[model samples]
Structure formats: C-alpha cells, structure tokens
Target: MADSDMGELAPSSSMDRRDPDLYIEDGNIVLSAKDNENNTVYFRVHKSTLVKNSPEAFGNMFSVPTPPNMDQYDGVPLVQMPDDAKSLRDFLTILYDPQCIATILKAEDFPKMLRPVELARKYQVDWICKLVASQLQSSWPDSLFQWNIVAREEGDIRAWDAYRTEAPEGDMDEPRGLRCLPEPVSSIILARQCDVPAILPVAFLHLLRFPSEIYDYNEVFPWQIPERSLLSQQDWARLVLARERITRWFTQEGPQPWKDCGTSGMQCQVITLTTWLNIAQEVAVDGNILKLYGRQVKGDICDKCKQKLEDRFYHLSVQFFRNLKHFFQLDE
Candidate 1:
C-alpha cells in the first residue's frame, strides 16, 4: 500500500490515514474504523488471520467471491468495521501480537481487556473471547482457597485504598482496587454482553459489597461504574435478594462457627466465636468480606485448636460462595 492509496494527506481532506505500525504493505485486506473525530483509521492485516481467527464471521464473509464494485483500498478489499478505532487498535494488537496474550492474562492488564473482549465477541472471535474469559474467571474466586490465593498475591490490599476518593471531575481513574479490578457493575455488564456466565456469579457477589450510593453514579470513585439502568430488572432483583440473603446468613448462621469443633480445649472455640461475632456485625453494615476475612484473630491458642477453627471457617466460606449462582438467580 502506498501513501497515495489513502490519497495524499491534504490539509482539507486528511480524515483518512493509515495506522503507523499496523498498516502492513503486503497485507491482503484492509480493516477500517472511525476514530473519535470521525477520522478513518485503517489497519492492513492478513486476510488469512481474520479467517483463521473468526471463521464463523469473517471466514464465512470472505468465502464468497468479491462482488463487482466492492470497496477497495490500494487494490486490497476493504472491510468497514463497526468498532471504534481505539478499541479496534487493541483488538488488532491482540490479533497481530501473539505475545500479548500473556500480557492480558495478568491481573495488571485486567482493565485493558474489556474493550477487546467486547470487540472479540462482536466480531465472533471465539479464541480471544475464551482466553479473556479464562483470565477473568481466574481473577475472581470459586472457593475460599482460590480467594485466599488471590488475596496473598494482592499483598496488603489496603495499599489499593488510594484508588478510592471523591469521584474525579472527569473520566474515572485507572486501576481502582485490587489489581485494577473492574467495578462489579462494569464486570457484570461485560459478562452479560459477552455471555461469559462463569464470571457472573462472582461479579454479582462482588457488587453486593459496594455502597448503595454507587447506583447514583455521582459517588466518588477511581474506577468507572456504568449506569445501573443498563442492568436488567431481573438482575437488579437478583442482586437485591442476594444481598438480603447474605446479610441474613452472616447474621444468623455465620458467627456460630465452632459448634462442631473437636478441640478438647474451650479456649479456641471461645476466642474464635467472639471474633466471628465481631465480623458478623461488620458484614451486616458493609458486607466487604474480602477485607473482613483478612482480619487476624487472636493466636494465643494451641496450633491444633487454631487449625480446627480455621478449617471450619474455610468450609463455611466455601459452602456459602458455591451458592452464589443460586443467590444471584444465575443457576438456571
């Protein structure tokens, strides 16, 4: 492709330009998207890559002969994309750079993933969707064991508290809390849009811990929270009901953790029970379990007794977490 293919960059008609690095001259096809100011940003990439990566959509699309008078850019077939240039750039980066898969898998690049995931689904890019979903599932928890593992990897989650403050006057800040975790609502929105059911249970559960004022969107935050109206009424009902059940369960049943304890000594049971009662009260008001779970109970007791209490607590946490889909009405 030549610069003249896009036309000489005239001051009056410079809305069309090639992506500096992505415009491969030897590429057989051109993918174009509109930038923020309505400029046309073009990416020249191999036709085989699109077919191989999106067999259901692009592959099927190109299976037929090119119709007469079809659009072209520098003799290459042009495909107009529905995606915006910024997101399309990220999507193309994932498509062109194989090494970037590992980058998106880490917790640090979590927020950068949403647009690509959304674009991948829109274009029926199955592999990218699966990879991003797997990364998301790992970021969340399926059991108390997994939760504790992520917690340790986070290394003193209080350090993330700087992400919270009065909402900025402009767009929300990046990397809000816990390894740039997407606000629960945003995750729920993406999960719903992309049909990633595995993420919904924990995403909904995470939302239960946030302050109710977040629904207003005017609340202070470092991360973006999409408007609550975007969520379906059914989801809202599920969230509300789930919150009630969580509060009830923690209050009525959560504190009595040592009942089946086999410990011969009563000291561990007494101390553990008292600690849980305090935790139960805090959960009633805030329901921020991740933060609460990290609190240290007195360790004066013998190791065996402490181990028994901890085992029982883990079991209960697991039991409750496994029911999140049910509580969120997603089990169906």
Candidate 2:
C-alpha cells in the first residue's frame, strides 16, 4: 500500500496487516515496517489507560506533591527557627546536650542567637554557659563580669572561675554587668528572673530609653493607663523636664544618626518623649479661678445669682463654681 494510504486503515487492521515479525514489547506496539531496511514503528498505549490498567507501570514514577519554593513562604527564608521562643527552645535543647554546644558555637553568625545563650545560662547548661562566657569575654571585654553574672544566674558555673580570673581589677565595687544589653534582652532576662511588676517599671524605663526597641508599645503599655497609676502632676512635670533635656541633647548633638539605627531604636526615644508629654497633659489642671467683679464694689452680691450678697461660700463663688463644674465635666 502507498505510504499515504496507511492513514485510511483502522489501528487494529493496520496492526494485523504488519509483518508477522511485528509484536508487542513492554506494553508498546512495535511493528517492523520494512524487513531489509530494519525500519520499525512503535506506539504506546495512552497514558491514562496505562495508569488505570497497570499498577506496576505507575510504581516506577514518584507521585510526591511538589514542595513550595522559598519565595512562596513568608518572612526570612533562613534562620530556620521561628521567632524568639522557638530559637530559645532549640538553644536550650542543644545546651542540655553538651555534644551540640561546640557545633552550635562554631556556626556562622553564632552571636545572633544571644537569646539561646541567655536561655542556656538560665537552664544551667555548663558547657554552653562556658562557651557563651568565653565568647562574651573575648568580644566584649568590658561586659565579662556582667556576662558572668548572667552565666552564674543561668547555672553555668564551669566558666564562673574563668570569669573571675579574667575579671578586670580596680573599681570592683562598681557594677560590671552587661550595660549595653538591648532592652528586649534585658526584659527577657527580667521576665525570666524577677517578678513582672518589679521588672515592669524597669522594662518601661528601657522602652522609654530605647523606644525603637519595642515593636508593640500599645501591647506593652495600653493607651488607656490606669487612673490610680497615672503619674502625679509633680511627677508629670518632672517627666516633661526630662523629655526636654533629652530633646535638647539631641538638638545640640545635631541629630545622632537615629535614622540609621533601625526603627526600634528610634521609636524607643520617641515613645519616652511622647509618653511624658501625654502624661503631663493628662495630670495638668488649670488653677485659675474666674472672678466677675461689678463696677460697684459690693462684697455681698451673689456672683452667679446676681441678686444680693449672701454669707454662703457657694453664693460668693457661685459664678466661678458653676464654671468649675462645667470644666470638670468636660475634662472627664
């Protein structure tokens, strides 16, 4: 038959018409079209039929769901453990297993895991504690004693002697702890170590000192401060003075690269100033007592009633009293 005529034949008729040498192999229809030329044509069953009819055929192929690409997920792709809590837990686990401490310490950017270091100290992981203390001493010579206290408190005593040995002499009475520890780190330590209330004021002070460090100010100190805890007028004035001092310092110092220091750093200073201003306004009361004096001096004339002078203080102060009452209600 002509080559074009082959198209007219049904698949089964064409298969039967092929040379007797034609056969099926591995589920594929293989037909020898020309003996001397060794020309052959092969066709496989439809993919849908193969999957439906033969379980063995599908077994060779993996059917896993595709994993999502890095961009598909949110936030930082690296630094695998999520947030401070997970990082702390993982760090504590590693510290408890001494064998892992050396490996973790050697990792790149190891200091970024300071939370874990603090956690290790808290949990009393000896090896991790020593490693942290050693690293801190080498990196922050000034903070060695402070870090030692951290280590000691955390129960890592192996490096306590090393801490003492390396402690700088002179002014031993002076506190030598981590002066530059960030507010978040300080708050974490306080929450872990001390009562929340005692530490709260300190934490709030830290927030005031380093407003940029706190991400959620509303969460930390809700907008509606308790009436009883509100600063007294005098204290509010003092806070305003302190804010002015900080602002003056910043103004004189010519704006200390606050913008480059990151949002938390900048916000810390802002929150302190803003909070002081807010509290000052909240407590300030206008003490001016309004007086209505008629052209004719009559001490007994009822200021509000304007009828005649009366002996009652209310009568003398009636106009001022009514105004005061209105002011108080508006203030509330």
Candidate 3:
C-alpha cells in the first residue's frame, strides 16, 4: 500500500503480495521474506523506527553503504529478511508498542515467548531479550522455596480437577483443565539458546518424568526428530544415564529411614519402615521425589517419629534436587 498509484502489490507478479497491515503507505524501506509457497511477501516500514529500537542490529546493517544494484520497490531500497512474515510481524508488533509490554506478555503463553526471544536475540534487541528471558526463568522453579510452591500449586490443580468432576451437575463450574507447564524439550533448548542454565536441571528433571518410550526409540537422532525430542545425542545420553541413577536411588537410598529411627520403640521402628516404603514407591512410580518436602504425609506416627520422617524427607528431596546437575551430567 504505497503512497504512489500502485493500487495493489505486484498487480502483474501474482506470486508476490504486500502485507496489508505492515505495508505503511509512506514508509521508506521494504522488508521481504519468502512465504511457504516460495512467494516473496513485502512489508513497507520505516527504517528509522526499526533502527531506533534495535540500534545494534539495524545500525550496523544500515550503516554500510548500499550495494550496487540493490533491490528496490516503489523507489525505496528493499532488504530481504531471513524470518517468516508472521514471526517478523510479531517482532514488529512487540517492538512498536513498548508501553504495552505487560499486556503483550500476559497474552502470550510461555512457549509462544520463544519466538520473540529468538527474534530479539537475532536482531540484538537487548531489552526485549532480557525481558523475555527473565519472564521464562520466573515461571520455572529456580530455588527450593519456589519448587515447594510449585508442588503445592500442582497439588491444588489436581484437587480442583477432582472437585469439578465429582460435584453435582448443577454445582459444576466452568470446564477447567488448563496447565501452563512449559514444554520440557523446547524449554531446555531455549535455556541453552538464551544462556539461562539455572533452569536446565529442573527442565531436565521434568523431561525425565516422561517415559523414554513416549518418544522415538532411535535416540541417536533425537534432535532431528522434532516430533519426539530436540535434544542432542549427548544430552539424550545424559538423560538416559540419569534415569538409571534416579531409579537406583529410589530402590536404595530413598527407602531408608533416618539413622536414629530404631533407637525409638518397636512400634515407631515398624511405622517408620512402613511410611518410608510408601513414599519411596509413590515417588518411584511417578518419578517425582519432590513430594517429600513441604507437604506433610499423614500417618499414625508419634511426634518424634513425624519429625524424623520430615527431616529425612527434607534431606532426601534436597539431595536429589541439588544433585540434578550431576545426574544430568551437566557442567557446573
């Protein structure tokens, strides 16, 4: 939609089209990318607007002298971009409306943020990159306190689902089964791409909870098979090894009661062993040892025995969580 008399983009060239919203009438530059059908879609936008926001990327790009015989559209210089039109549109939408960042962020789910973050990094948009990265890290459980809160929240979600399902038809609330948990494979890759290694251990732990058989058996080409996983061979191998280690821990260390448990009466000792077995079996099947911490396990045990169990659970959860780095064979 140029200011000139060109009523439609490529009136002659049917293979091309102009983005209705992005093709500003008086814009001085043109951006182009091939759509799925291999047709070039052109966007006319202001160069100064882009440069003003992403100085490092646009400044360097435009600062260079225009090459001889550069592509032109409606007398303005054309610059072909590598990104698809939709993603580029999203980038411009976020870049143009800095004041509406919170609104934009809230509307976007965690996985959807990946595109903007990727585009931000590619275009050297510092503030946008940092903003998205900080948001992603916050959504994940970074510390034990945060992890404990997540555990509680998930428990509540389960309870909520149960309540809605079991309630009378007249009392049933609106349908609610939304879980905003991040996609583990993409989250891990995004962390590596954005250099946020702190979230990796938890992400890896979440991925490990899923049976490897859910994905392709040919682990050698994990990254190539996007339908399965995008992890490199080394990362996949590390997870495989960690699964064995975790299972071994559940069988061995996880069931053992506190060192001083037997010193109590015979009933206390028997109850401790029974409680330990129940917790270990539950975690082993679910592959979520994190339940041991923060949530009190109800059983018929004395206060002293309860304290001992809590202490044991706390220590066990801490050990497994903190050692996640070693389990996944990640470098500190």
For model 2 the local lDDT of residue 308 reads 23
Q: Let me know the TM-score candidate 2 reaches against the reference structure.
A: 0.19
Measured by lDDT, the strongest candidate is 3
lDDT of 2 by residue, 164-274 (tens): 446786423433342232333333233333222223322222223333333442322221122223334553453344444434432332222233333354454454344
lDDT of each: 0.68, 0.33, 0.70
**lDDT over C-alpha atoms for residue 196 of model 2:** 28
Q: What is the TM-score of each candidate against the true structure?
A: 0.65, 0.19, 0.77
Tell me the spans in candidate 2 whose CA falls farther than 4 Å from its real position: 1-88, 95-100, 107-112, 141-332
What clash pairs does model 1 have? 167-220
**Candidate number with the higher TM-score (1 or 2):** 1
Query: What is the alpha-carbon lDDT for the whole of candidate 3?
Result: 0.70
40-76 per-residue lDDT for model 1 (tens digits): 8889999898888888888888899986556677667
- Shift in Å, residue 321, candidate 1: 2.3
Better of 1 and 3 by lDDT: 3
- The alpha-carbon lDDT assigned to residue 156 of candidate 3 equals 62
Predicted candidate 3 versus true structure: per-residue lDDT over 88-132, tens digit per residue: 877776776775556645543445556677788898888876775
